[model samples]
Target: MERPIGVIDSGVGGLTVLHELKRQLPKEQFIYLGDTLRCPYGSKGEEEVIQYTWEMVNYLMKFDIKMLVIACNTATALVLEQLKQNLPIPVIGVIEPGARAAIKATQSNHVAIIGTENTIHSQAYEHALIRIKPNIDTTAVACPKFVPLIESGNFVLEEAKEIVEESLEFINHYPTIDTLILGCTHYPIIQSLIEEVVGPRVTVLSSAVETGFEVSTLLTFYNLYHANTEEIHEPAIFTTGKLHVFQRLKEDIFQLKNASLKHITLS
Candidate 1:
């Protein structure tokens, strides 16, 4: 009764979610797949995004995962409901949890969201927020350069800081916004930089963290909690692109000890 949780993302961005999952539910095993070959589903069309997300779901299903977490925002925005309807296992996405967190964090009734072009365009987070609280004001900005910078391993460089500052300039004029949602999973990789740019006043939210909480709640709701409190395997990692970068981040950035990663191809 210790089937693993399946977490999928377009790339290493989902590691942020995995980090939280591990912190919150240490006893549970996880199988994380990053479709890095097709990284940045943020730029793709709705159909292509949905197709790629399904390919991920199909790939992860082979592991007999007890739960599924769509850790990628673009995929969640485009394909989550469909996956929930069709997949036998319980499925959850990062958006609703993120929106709820934003609702809880914002005291000014104003929230700002930063994500990829497609995510902001979809207005998924805005709609989710509005559905619960009709009077909230939301402003969404697309930071098109972030995902690639993060995927390329340049997110920590000074150029990335410049880009973040430039891309977020719009929020400076948005005086009322007291909360900012990192709508794209990739954004949390540079959460400090975002907080620096946004200054100390506006609270930055990581959807990954909130998603982890939601996953824990559902694990209990569905009675899918891993019974082993002692643990089993070093969480398995798979990627459809080059392994070196993912490996470096997992070891150095995340300090995931003895974790094994493999190269994978998704049809």
Candidate 2:
């Protein structure tokens, strides 16, 4: 029960989820692995995404994690079921939590989703939404350029604003959509820009909060909550690529000054 939870993503994007989890369950420890070197899994083939995701999971399993959180939308879409069935610990994904959040936020039962190419093409959010609310109206857009822009650490520039605007132009056509789901975990890093582009009429929701809540609920159900309240927990973060941006985000964005970060390679 004291074992750390494992969170994995294609890149630093998963930190958004990790941040929420830490806030919600302050006593629990977390180990994060971001496959930054071969990131942008949104455009990769299904087989490749599955393989890469499994590699990340296999690596995390070494730490004797109590649970696994698939923080990448593409990997969640492609491999969540397999991980859930095969792994001893519970597994949760961002898509269903995100879909539920969008459904709850929408006034018209119409929602829009924007994510990586593979996630959009997989229709995972749309299906999750419709399955929960059978009559929900959903529109999905594939923003293949987002991950690269974010990974470059240039998402704060004016060019990022233009890219976000251009990528979301289609949202204007859907007047009925009162809720927009940030389908990819990385999207929340640029949530303000996305909200500006789509305007105030639509509410932008990130699955991180809901995902964190779900994690807390599961931990309690299984009695996996960390028993020691006085322990200071510093998350362990790992990435397979450059560390500059990851380090900056950890300190500046996530405010995890004491979190341990290291570069890692997977074969």
Which candidate ranks first by TM-score, i.e. highest? 2
lDDT string, candidate 1, 1-267, tens digits: 599999999999999899888888888898999999998889888899988999989999999998999999998888988998999999999999999999999999999999987899899999999998999999999998999999999777899999999999999898999999999988898999999999988999998778888999998898888887776567899999999889888988776767789998888
**lDDT, model 1:** 0.91
lDDT on C-alpha atoms for all candidate structures: 0.91, 0.93
**Candidate 2: tens digits of C-alpha lDDT, residues 26-139:** 999999999999998999899999999999999999999999999999999999999999999999999999988887898998899999989988899988988999998888
Candidate 1 colliding pairs, count: 0
Each candidate structure's count of clashing pairs: 0, 0
For model 2, state the Cα shift of residue 3 in Å. 0.4
